[model samples]
Target: MTSKARLIYNPVSGREQMPKNVADILDVLEQAGYEASAFRTTPEKMSAQNEATRAAKEGFDLIVAAGGDGTINEVVNGIAFLEDRPKMAIIPAGTTNDYARALGIPRDNIPDAAKIILKNKTRKMDIGKACFNKKTQYFVNIAASGSLTELTYGVPYEIKSALGYAAYLIKGAEMLPHLTENEMRLTYDDGVYEGKLSMFLLGMTNSIGGFEQIMPDAQLSDGLFQLIVVKPSDPGNLLKLMALALNGKHVDDPNIIYTKTRSLKAELIGKSEGKDLPVNLDGEIGGYCPVSFDNLKQHIEFYVGC
Candidate 1:
């Protein structure tokens, strides 16, 4: 009997190379003794999530997500809730493969990534779940809201696939001037905090948008999220914090609030009520505010290089 692997990829992801690399991907999997099949996501019909779920139900021994952070999020969400989920693998074919970066996967080389998968080592990792206005989504990397965070999703798909990571910088610059401050009360495992903040991020892994030190102490299997909140500040102060974040020194700054928590409940206050504050999960638009976040520890096993 042969083990089966399902490769679910987004053709438009990253530099649009997955479609061209399909044969090489399958060859690599075959050499590793797995019978592999492929699925290309289509905007008109099936999504990455749907294909992932179908592959899992059909009992694929491995489910490989070949795309960027958004594609990984969709595949993870599709199977994370299933009782018998397949082990996950990555191709890192996206602009910002944050999850892949966290795992030290080769982001630009698909063949090397396939070889890593062939090595077959596995590690248990956490997943982040957010619920808002009766909507729920699962994220394997990070979940955040406020300020210019929504720029991740705002960058048009074409520009992102064309220019890769640089597209985010362009969009971020365009969005920075319009950033909003939200007044909210955050209730976590230990206590409650009420204030106005430019952004708040719940991270399961330290690698986020290329800022590896943003949550330097994050532990993926710990069942807790490293929450970082940026207090309201002038543009100048915010720029300073951005520099501090790159070095993981912002946690001690008075304008920054950092802690570890397993669960968090955020409710809008003051003028933020009824407002459509953007929420992002694993680099995609999740929903609005008044959300609860829970860390699901050791939620999935992945084929990783150790």
Candidate 2:
């Protein structure tokens, strides 16, 4: 039986090039030995995710997520929980395309990125499962919470499309002087950190916001997450830590809690006063704090560059 492929893409992402590239992308998938179809995501909330779930249920052999990281996250979340998840591929169209960078997939050319499926060099990928009470969500690369991380969320879409990671830097600087220190108890494989923290990050891949060394110890399928908890510091001290992070040596800093864990739980402490400390999952606001994450090791297979 021939394998069937579903191409789910966000039409408005980046330069909106997917519509023009659809035919070529499908041809590339066809050349890789599959009967492929494309689905342009609508604005009807979770459209990509819904289509992804439908395609997976229909027994598609491959589900190719084409667009920015957000689109990829939706697709992954749609099927990551399934017992029999289909293999995945990516054609990046977002600003930074951090996950694609980690996969060694070409970001500038959609067809070239898809061509990786033909190369057939891939491995099982670790999926991060974040749970809040009865609800669950998933992440493909980085999950973070902090004032600086939240700044990126408020940046104008036009600026994001125009400047990419640089926009994050610009916005982060603006928000630093008024940073929000979250009081949370963070539990990891080693121990617990309960105190005031400026931010915490859980990374499944090394690349985040176009910074390759941000999570240097991250492994794609190790069934572990590299967790970094930044203790509360003034703007100047936080800037210093930021510098250290660029070289992947920030783990050695006293102000930073760096460790690896298969599971992690983050809960608000007394200082929080029951207010929500938002959790940013793969660059998007996933849910409130009190989130528990389990590293779903080798959960999804993918088409990665050799």
Candidate 3:
């Protein structure tokens, strides 16, 4: 029996590469001997996600997400909860192809990324479920909360496309001076922490924002999250820790909480008492915080480069 596949892409991501390379990508899928088709995401919210759901239900054996991390996250969300989800592939076309970077898939090359499907290399990737504000959202790369993390979505979409990773740097620098600590209670396996937190990251992969050292020990199929929590610190100390993170040496920092867990709960207390913190899911604002996270171990299968 011939396998079937669906390609879901964001037209404007990666400065409009998806549309231009559509034919080549489809050809690559064909070369891999799969019956293939494509779907273009619309301005209508959840477009990719809805399409992904439909395609998976229709019994496509493969789903190729050909845009940015947001597009991939949507595709994953569409079917990760299903009893029989399809295998996935990524064509990295975005400002910071964080997920692609982690997958060892080439970024900025649509057809080449699609061709990775032909290599027959694959893996089961862990997926994260975040629950907050009576809503559930899923993430495949990283989930974070804090003022600094706002940089993920704070950069305008248009600006991000044109400036790429530089846009995030600019935004980070601008927000650094104004950073504020939040009264936080973080609960994880074996222990709990109650203190001021500058930021916290739950990473399922080694790469984050184009840097791999932040979660150097992260493994896609580990069934665990590498949780990194930043304790409140002066700007100078915070900067120092960030520098250490670049080299994967921050794990021992006194102001950092680095551990592995299958689940976690992050609560905001005091000042922002009842206020909700925005949760960044795969670089998009997923929902508000006071959130709980659960790792679905090796929940989704995907074509990956070795």
Q: Pick the candidate with the highest TM-score.
A: 2
Candidate 2 backbone collisions, by pair: none
The reply for model 2, stretches above 4 Å from the true place, is none
Local accuracy of candidate 2 as per-residue lDDT tens digits, 45-79: 89999999999999999999999999999999999
What TM-scores do the predictions have? Answer: 0.93, 0.97, 0.96
lDDT of 1: 0.85
Q: Order the numbered candidates by TM-score, best leading.
A: 2, 3, 1
Candidate 1 wrong stretches, greater than 4 Å: 156-177
Residue 178: error of model 3 in Å?
Answer: 0.8
Please give the RMSD to the true structure for each candidate, in Å. Answer: 1.9, 1.1, 1.4
lDDT of 1 by residue, 183-245 (tens): 999999888989899888888988877678989899879899999888888776776776687
User: What C-alpha lDDT values do all the predictions have?
Assistant: 0.85, 0.88, 0.88
lDDT of 2 at 196: 87
TM-score of 3: 0.96
Q: Over the full model, what C-alpha lDDT does candidate 2 score relative to the true structure?
A: 0.88
